[model samples]
Target: MPRTREPFWRRLLAGTLPLLVWSLHFAFAYGLAAAQCTPAGMRPGGPDRALLGAVTLAAIGACAWLAWRAREVPRREDAGLLDWARLVLAVLALVAVAWTGVPLLLVTGCA
Candidate 1:
């Protein structure tokens, strides 16, 4: 049988969301560390930093869900195991964000 093709948007979302999430995650992590290390006494072990992390993760999760639902539309059936794996990873990542994010936020006073 011929291979199916995914729509442009579906492919775009699938490719972009994870990257966006990861970048945000890393940026926040590093940002907090740097901010804390600066002369400003701003530390990562505060509530505000933790809140930022949690919020960032939540946003990532929401975006991933949106992407997943979008993929369910009339997109091409060419989606393979890898495609599904990526989506699953996105979800798992979101969960990780929540798990680690909440505590971080609470401790950091970012909440």
Candidate 2:
């Protein structure tokens, strides 16, 4: 059976959504850390690790879902560059989110 063509906007979104999500995650994580780790009120611990973990997990989940959706494209003979890009971007985003989240787990506070 032939697949219906998706709109260009939709195709572009699926291809780059992962990177978008990753960028958001990166910004949020660092922003939160910086805001909470001020010298004025040097807390005993670092930023709110729990909240960071939750956001990281949510971002990872989003990336994983996107990657799963694009999984079949790699197996299709007619798949184009955008199709491959979608899968690659999703996987890259997933790894990036995980890697960024690691420091939150290890670092205590602004020490």
Query: TM-scores, in order shown?
Result: 0.53, 0.89
Candidate 2 lDDT score relative to the true structure: 0.91
Q: Give the per-residue lDDT of model 2 (tens digit) for 1-111.
A: 777688889989889999999999999998888888888655578888889999999999999999999999867998999999999999999999999989876788696
**Model 1: which ten-residue window has the lowest total lDDT?**
102-111
In candidate 2, the residue pairs with backbone N, CA or C atoms under 3 Å apart (3 or more residues apart, or in different chains) clash, namely 45-109, 46-108, 46-109
Residue-level lDDT of model 1, residues 1-111, one tens digit each, is 765586767766665576567567756765765566565655455435645765675666675675576465335586765566556656666665555455455553332
Taking the candidates one at a time, how many backbone clashes does each contain?
11, 3
- Among the numbered candidates, top lDDT falls to 2
> Candidate 1, 100: how far from true, in Å?
3.4
Cα deviation of 108, candidate 1, in Å? 4.4
